[model samples]
Target: MAHIVGGIFTSHVPAIGGAIARGLQEDPYWKPFFDGFHPIHRWLAAARPDVAVLFYNDHGLNFFLDTMPTFAVGAAAEYHNADEGWGLPVMKPFPGAEALSWHIIEHLVASEFDITTCQKMAVDHALTVPLALSWPGADNRPVRIVPIALNTVQHPLPSPSRCLALGRAVHDALASWPGAERIVIFGTGGLSHQLDGERAGFINKDYDRFCLDHLGPEPEALVAHSAVDIVELAGSQGIEILNWIAARGALGPDVREVSRNYHIPISNTAAATMLLETPATLSKAA
Candidate 1:
């Protein structure tokens, strides 16, 4: 049986890591939350899961303004980070776990969950940038990535319930796969913030805290709320909460919050990280 090593809930604000690296955490606004990840180096060393099922949403980079699938999976042997006109350097190539990815794809499609699979696609910086920065130990080493991207950049995206259901589908698919030793399920995106238009730079620490609370103890409550309402609280582009539903699914009912950090200095971004595991995870490590 496979167990979720932990869940990391964080913002992809791009410059945050550089800020931390430059000791900008002492800059009054970012110090607390940035310092929170200090022990993370040790944690990653300990858990050291074989792979991470990265759930992220494309920002008009891969899908574009064209037709976008509600849910897409990357089963490619490798994913390249191409230019996204964002001025950031291209991300290093990621080694995707194609074997498990194909297994999950086959299982999910057979279970009637429509999934768009990509092989020859270039992964946008939105998906690859933040990921590459997180692994301090990963000095261009290829770590297997199982990307489960959502069509969140567009309107009429899948409802909250649908995302939650998709999480279960992911959980079941991985659990049913044989000989999978350890896995980490990552839900990347927001707590509450908005980017775009004049209304940009909106930061709602209150809403972000509510998200962490509800995501941990009462996910159903959060899911029951409509996307429109959440959009109002989380901002127009705040629909990224769907990524959190996948984290909830990975954590299950008996989820534990190892640590949580919420900050609003970056204006349009909320930074957070959470660790989740089952009782069986310790034995798996043993």
Candidate 2:
């Protein structure tokens, strides 16, 4: 049986992927952080999991506020990349692993996760763009995907504890599977930056670090934090740390950081990536 490798966190800021591609690392503002994620490239290479259960929230593209589900898993054969104002660069399209997906969905519900599954739906740029940027090429090849989309666009989104519970259920579901040997779970979203209103430019380095601290090996702290508290600190609509908490909760305690990177530019968002490994060594911390 394969081990449930664990989770990763990253920002899906569109423009930044292009910036990094254009050698933004040379900019004094971004270099140290780019250096921070370089280790991820290395970690990814070594782990080489058979599948990646990716979690990403759409920016009102795929799941609109009209009829939103708390969480949806893609059981589609192929996902089209739609433009979100800016035309997304076409990369390889990922064909989800239906077998694994069905198993996960079945077990998640049995565990009371209640995830929505889509047989066919066009995957928006929110997921593909960041995934492509993170791992160029090799779609559904080295790492088969089971795409999970969260409904963070709508207000009164799943409560922090609810999201965390779902994550714990996800871990249980994955562990129950007897076939898959190596799996990588990813939770993609924000860390303290707002994109609208007068508070748009806010960036909280302290909060970001605090989140990473509590996420790994101790998510109870975040569970104790109120939604209002997170919104106030991270911004009104920036309370998506719940997504990260979900991913962390699934991984449970006894985790170690493989890599961490943080960067903030003119855009009203902070980009960060954290890689957690299960049964990780004590020295892996940054």
Candidate 3:
């Protein structure tokens, strides 16, 4: 059976990607933000999972107002990055795990989680930026990916509990796969800070810190919050924290937090990153 090595959580801010592309890690204004991802880079180098189950939202690249699925999974052989308006430095295409993608889709639907499967999808920064941060030279890495896109931008988004339940479903689906593969899950976006409207440039370090401290050990505490609650406190886009909740649910209760980093003001967003692992004993049992 396949084994889940761990889950990664991070903020998917585009400016962070720009910093990396320009080699501004040591620049005074960008130094602190870049420093937050150093541990994640080192961890990926060490663990080197075979596939990454990425959880992120589309920023008008693939899905626009025309049609949007609440939950979608990418099953294509490859996913290319798109120029999200500003023409951020485009990275190499991401290799996709079609077999695993189909398996997950079948399982999620059977488990009653309605999910749309995309054979061809162009990912925006929400997907590419975090990949750049976790696996710096991704083009040369051996990792494949299964992209799970959520609809946080539109209203009637999935509830925190529902997202958590979906994560648990993904956990079961991956575990039941009849292969000996190492997989890492990631929940991307949000640590407070809003853009747009009069409340733009808002930051709530205390609320963000509360989530970081509790999400791993007590994710249930977060499930009680509605999208409105999060938007009001964390910012409109702050509801993206639901992605983290989903990732936490997939990790199960027997996890060891490997490392965590949080910083404020990464281009109108508070940035955060965390690495979590299934305990060795739990992995063996599963």
Candidate 4:
């Protein structure tokens, strides 16, 4: 049966795409963030998952404000990147795992999650930047992708508890699939940074540190805060943590942190990278 290999979580700051375009990995300001990926590359090298089930939020590329779905899944054969007017170069398309995407769609619906299924979706930096960070260089991405976009862009957004449950349902779906593929979960976006409002350019490092510390062992700790509470503390755009929370749910319980990097002010966000997985013995024993 198909099994989850691990989950990779990171901030999908737009400037990351620009940094890549300008070859700024070693630049003093970008160095700390870029260096975080070196260990992620090493982990991916060792884990070798065949497919990635990505959890991210769309940024007006595929879904606009008026037509956004709370949750959407991609069933396309390939996903292309487009210009979001952010001046970031378009990334090469990522091949999709269509069958697996459909299977996940079916399972989510059966579990009562009401997810929108997209046959053609244009991925933006949120999805592409993480792939670039995990597998740098041309033709380097070795896994098929299954994109799952959450509604972080709009208000009346799903709660942290709900997203967590959605992820758990996805975990169950992967477990029931009869394929032999090894899957990795990608959760993109945010530690703590706000883009607009009176608190514009706001970031809460202490809260971010609390989240990073408990995401694995005590995710419910995060769920205790209301959506309004998150906005008050982490900023408006910081609601992107919903993506990370959902990805954590898909990982199930007892995950070991392989490596983590946290740095502040990565283009208006507190950038973070964390690689988590179930213990090898536990995975095998299951």
Against the true structure, whose lDDT is highest?
Answer: 4
Cα lDDT, model 4, residue 110: 94
Per-residue lDDT over 1-286 for candidate 1, one digit per residue giving the tens place of the 0 to 100 score:
6666766666666566445345465788777666666565556678877787888888766787578889998889988777666555665677888888898899889889888998755676445644644574324553477888887777777888888888878888887878555777778777677778776877667777777887877788778777887788887767788888865775556665766666666645776766555556656667
- The window of 10 residues in a row where model 3 has the poorest summed lDDT is 277-286
Summed backbone clashes in each candidate are 2, 1, 0, 0
Better of 1 and 4 by lDDT: 4
Tell me the deviation in Å of residue 202 in model 4.
Answer: 0.3
Off by over 4 Å in 3: 281-286
Off by over 4 Å in 4: 281-286
RMSD (Å) of each candidate, 1 decimal: 2.4, 3.0, 2.0, 1.7
Q: How well is each residue in 1-286 modelled by candidate 2, as lDDT tens digits?
A: 6576656787766665555456575687666555666677677777667777877787766678788998888876666666676544555567666787888789887877777888876666556644654565424356667788877767677778888888888787777788845788788778787877888788887888888777776888887877777888887645768778878876765787777777764257777779888883233223
The pairs that clash in candidate 2 are 2-181
What order do candidates take by TM-score, descending? 4, 3, 1, 2
Winner of 2 and 3 under TM-score = 3
* lDDT, candidates in the order shown: 0.72, 0.72, 0.85, 0.90
- By summed lDDT, the worst window of 10 consecutive residues in model 4 runs over 277-286
Worst 10 residues of 1 by lDDT: 133-142
Off by over 4 Å in 1: 17-29, 137-142, 283-286
lDDT of 3 by residue, 175-282 (tens): 799987789889999989789999999988988988998888899888878878888889988989988988888777778777888877788899998888788534
